[model samples]
Target: MALSDDTMRGVNLGGWLVLERYIKPSLFTVPECFDKGLHDPDVCTNDVDDAYPQDQWTLTGLFKNKDDARKYLKDHWANFVKEDDIIRIKNAGLGYVRIPVGHWIMGDISPDEPYVDGEWGDFVRVVKLCRKHGIQVWVDLHTAPGSQNGFDNSGRTLPTPTGVGWSGNPENVDRTIKAVRDIAEGIKQEGIEDVVTGFGVLNEPFKGQNEAQVKDFDDRAYRAVREVLGEGTTVYIADMFDAERFNGFWDDEEHGNTVLDSHYYHVFAQTPRGFSPRQHIAYVCEKNSRDVNACCWKGGGAGGGTSVGLKRMIGEWSVSFDTLVCTKLDDVMDSYREGGEVLEFTRKIGEKRKKFLRNFAEAQMVAWESQDTGVSVGWFYWNFKMEGGAFAEWDYLRGVEEGWMPTLKAEEKAEHVFGRCEEIIFRTDDEMDIVHEFPPSDSVAPDWQAVEADDDVVVSHGESLLTKGSRERGDGIVLGFLSLVVFLLLGLGIAKKCCVRYFGGAGGKGGYQRVGEVGGVGEVA
Candidate 1:
């Protein structure tokens, strides 16, 4: 009933799990007869062999079709969900794993063509393993039938959360919602109902969020699921979209089991206004200010449980470091999170960044635990399993850093793997202990490299994360009203001040005073 801490922090499979990280700009279009028209607007619409503009789609990985996408996942995606990792994950004594799945994946029961009977089969295996290890699975349908995020992240284009300009076709929406419902039904009929703890309807349903429409769509989707799986399925709906900004919806009162979920990031509050990575390499993320609007409705944060009593989960989050991956090129993150020269290369965001982020991330978890969102509950870190070093199409890492693959070491695994509680604890739950394993190098040199381009010699989403790899992945939300009017004191690191008068608050109305070395603009007029 009470979502535990382990459930609160979990990892994502990323890249291989479902979506392609990013594509080479040059591969605009491939083959002689392929329909280049189906190309995503976000991707450079050009010849496959031609190069695309790098900056535009660098963050989003492109995919030709679902098969190509799944193949990479099946071959390269290894089990990072190890016993030790699980043991570490549950260190906080939590109970669930929020697994992000591409809604693009559908069975012939799939309308988008070529649906595999077991598209999510391997993932299911991982889920069952987690269940056996005492981890519950929160199936996050990260993207919808069409791409939720049109950028490279969606893995495709045409249909994205932005809606790509369709005639407010209720029919189209129904069809799309049905596709997802079918998947839910499949998931239920597959005999793995208990393995799935909850279902995240659509990730960042942000673009076309019409409060009435979104509510209708969600209600319809829920009904469809019941049509197949029957009653009692817990559903999760994320509110990144401005549509149906209402907190009116949460649990299926009629059926009575659901969770209203939301995601967050602190990049905005951490960065100063007019601040761009002009001096430093450009680094950015979804704006948190927009997220504030996305997440907070009068009763969204702490207390106010009646207006929105559906359980919410901030599924993913991390302190993003404007970092370049490891120079070693082989074992990058091996030394990033805690130590090494990489730490110095992190972000220009500064110590204020760290203090602000740590406090921000920690507070959300604590609030979600103590505050009565009655509307939401628990969370999963944006990601956990960043072990992307599979070689020869099947090789994978042992841990985030260490090279001990969990598949071969099942006997040694436990409830918490790669202990997040030990690694990053905002507030400990006295009942648990956490620990993490960061290897000394990026990875053991794979027998071979799955190089898409011999010239670039890219790896894992072509990020070469090992070399110039990123230190942060985004997801998670901080619920606080104070953050709205106050500005982070960049110079003082942790000092927060009222933004109303900037220099005159705290001292009587318009009183100008001098205290010690500090000057105040207010004078008791």
Candidate 2:
């Protein structure tokens, strides 16, 4: 099926349905540990406790471990994100909401732990409210049974803060599939399937583990859900960390309705090339547009229908701007620590920086919408709200209110090039192989400069050449060929002229006479 105009404009209900340390740190509180010295030097490797100790910072950690405040935590689930949040999302002119949930929400994996079960009813309430407000939902299984991603957001992490949740154990994969089945089948049973646009089977499930097993497990989870949900359900799979590798996994018709989700973020951009934010923005837009489109459409060519059974979208994206060079902060959590510092730096530049950021955010939205890759069906901004206030690019509601992101729902026509087809026309059964790419962006190209090189050959643009010798050889071949051609033509013309003048004359013999025969006649004269 083709994408609708409104389908693409959505916001993630982050930190509300799911607990992320950076988005809602207070929810991960460990009040009992307050008496203990800040960070308890022994428990946390980084002894700085401007936030909760890393060990007690995740949703699963807050319940499974002793320091986690369980009593207060249960109450947080009800109060953190309310019905009003859903109303606000609708009012923001967004038509979609990506609700992230952990597998534990289905059942307590560790029942012996002191943690009481959370109200799964809260999730049902959120999904219902979103449906009531006409907002399509993508129920994303953000945290799998094993920490899919070895991060606090994964619901649990290793004591050393590594994520080893999916240890290739058969049980981990089984539990995860069961949880996904519950969520997908539950949505179907509720009779609200129309409002539920898709079910994301996994979110960022990557660890330094067996790559092959992980892929098999991903495919198995999707197949299990498809088996339950049937051929009509839209199941989305997070490209298992490497989007390119997992691009065509769901190309088969048996996969049913599916889309590949990959996140696009620039906080991790490294700048040895000295790219300014503007240049970096251009580079990402161009590069991802190509890569994502390449991933989406696979068959005869781009927009090719060999893979119409599969589709793609950016399940998570953000306008939060920071390079490794600017703040040395790599992840959102690290950036959260120094948000105020970055804001202060922005304030020093007055509105100049803010203006640049607003443009940057719009540029990103435009880029994703106009992707050359088989079209990014739609994208969900990383978050709708966060604790970081105006500086938070993850917060889509704030970005729109603050003038960074464009409002696509209420507009007369889609503004982005890729979004020009607000009313999508699906291909006929036979012509399904045809697909389209987003229009190219009208922006300044990246500024490139040659750097001092150590190697004899330098890579420029995308080619390698022995410049001096190559140029000389090319010129020599052309000049030499021209000279030979000219000599041949001149010699042929002279021979023709001699034949015409001597042989064609009145007394000319049919056969030619040599100069030596004429010399012998001169002796008689």
Candidate 3:
């Protein structure tokens, strides 16, 4: 069978639980710490940054016993497992929901009250919701305790900073593998279809001490997951230390029943914070696809890989920008094209961006499916939602498009957004050979109305992105001047070596003269 299931294509459900900035928010929490930490005796505000590790960023525990953690999940189900979440996933036409769980949810990470017997129900509810909606669920071990990825994304970090290869500790290694396997067995036992479609071993593997260590960790995880679920489950492993470390999985064929999940972000080279969400998505999609032509050989493309499947399912991607603003730039922010000139100059930038957003969304869709990287599954975004920081609107997207419209009210608005997402895949799904796609010009049409500024509510073009940034259009004048300077320097180098300016050098010992005039055989000078 082909390594992919096309029927599963649609919007992704992310950011629902974890993104809430550590489970409980002030106003959002029913048991509100109404008084600021400054006023509360139970809370101590240490102005000293080091005294309080960044761990303070989250109110969640460093690690909780599996049972208590499980109970907490069930009690908070209404908050974390909102109805809109289910609606959004289904409404968006997505057949799968990849829910990321912290290691605390799996007893292995907590070790004390480890993943308690009943805590599994929180996930069971999520899985059941998917089944109820005809959606497949893929469980992602998002935040593994002990820093699989030292960053906060891992949900837990070493009480102290340690180098990579936490697996070398033997205990950690055992726990990590056991967590995944237990999850697999848990779902299987529940009669839930988690592994029937897929499940991820861990979020992104960490960037630590040694290459061999990561591989060993990967191998162990592979063995562990395979143990409980056997052939029925497809193990998904995120690329740690970039793709090269794990690229061997497909080549060596050492791994079986697994899909290599990978991620892509444009910050590696493109301008930093320069790309809006749409721009980032479009850039990643374009860059990945543009890179696909070179996928014929690794090290040739920007990402340095040659897998058709990897290119198509270039897994996780995200950007730091307002979602409503990025996607609906022009139409939401009344454009200069539509009315006033100042508004045009004030928001002409918005006009230009809408064009880019449309193109970007389409391009990403094109790039994602343009290849076969021997991976058909295990791909997910950094998250589907967030509590406060607007890294993305995945939570909102999941809720509105997949959650509310489909599940709660089955609203038309939800249907429209889902339609837009579907149109993108329809335009680029490999199954649809883009050879017959609309011509490139039509392929990148602009929708000026997308950001017309309604109460400046739906969009923020996000800092003027130079509308006239082209050479012929007088955009890169400074850069053009720099290019000229470089060319002049190059020309001088050639002249120095080839133009040869002759000079008198010791006329008696090292005399130099015009050819015929200087040579004794010809004419002495």
- Where is model 1 more than 4 Å wrong at Cα? 1-9, 20-49, 52-73, 77-88, 91-93, 108-118, 157-161, 164-172, 241-244, 250-252, 268-309, 321-360, 370-375, 387-525
Residue 442 lDDT, candidate 2, scale 0-100: 16
Which ranges of candidate 3 are over 4 A from the true structure? Answer: 5-58, 62-75, 109-119, 157-165, 194-196, 252-254, 267-270, 275-287, 290-312, 319-358, 371-379, 385-525
Clashes of 3: 53
What does candidate 2's lDDT look like per residue over 1-525, in tens digits? 224544467888777645665565434444433324444443433324444444223433433343434454667667766778788788878778888887766664654322234657777777788878888888888776557666655665555333355645677778888888887777778777777767888887764566677767778777777677666567787765456665556566676467778786654332212333433343333344444665655542555653665676788777564422112212334444543342222322234444555555555565566533335677788888766442355667766676655566545323243221110100001111111101111122222211121111111110111122224446666545643453354345322222212211112111122223222110211
lDDT per residue for candidate 1 within 1-525, as digits (tens), equals: 323323244544444344432211112222221235444433322444343322212212334454543443344335434466556655534456777665545652345433233446667677767777777777766554344445334434443236432115565565557666867876776777777757766666545445566667777776776676665456767665331254545422463555566554322121211122110011111122123223333344323333323544566544332221212212332323223353222222233332333433433343333232233345555445332321100111222223221221222222123222111111111110111112211232221111111111110111121121111212112212222212233223333322212222212111111123321111100
Cα lDDT over the full model 3: 0.41
lDDT of all predictions:
0.39, 0.53, 0.41
* Per-candidate clashes, comma-separated: 79, 6, 53
Cα error of candidate 1 at position 106, Å: 3.1
User: Relative to the unseen true structure, what is the C-alpha lDDT of residue 245 in candidate 3, on a scale of 0 to 100?
Assistant: 49
Q: What's the C-alpha lDDT at position 306 in model 3? A: 46
Select the stronger candidate by lDDT from 1 and 3: 3
The TM-score between candidate 1 and the true structure equals: 0.54
The stretch of ten residues in a row with the least summed lDDT in candidate 3 is: 500-509
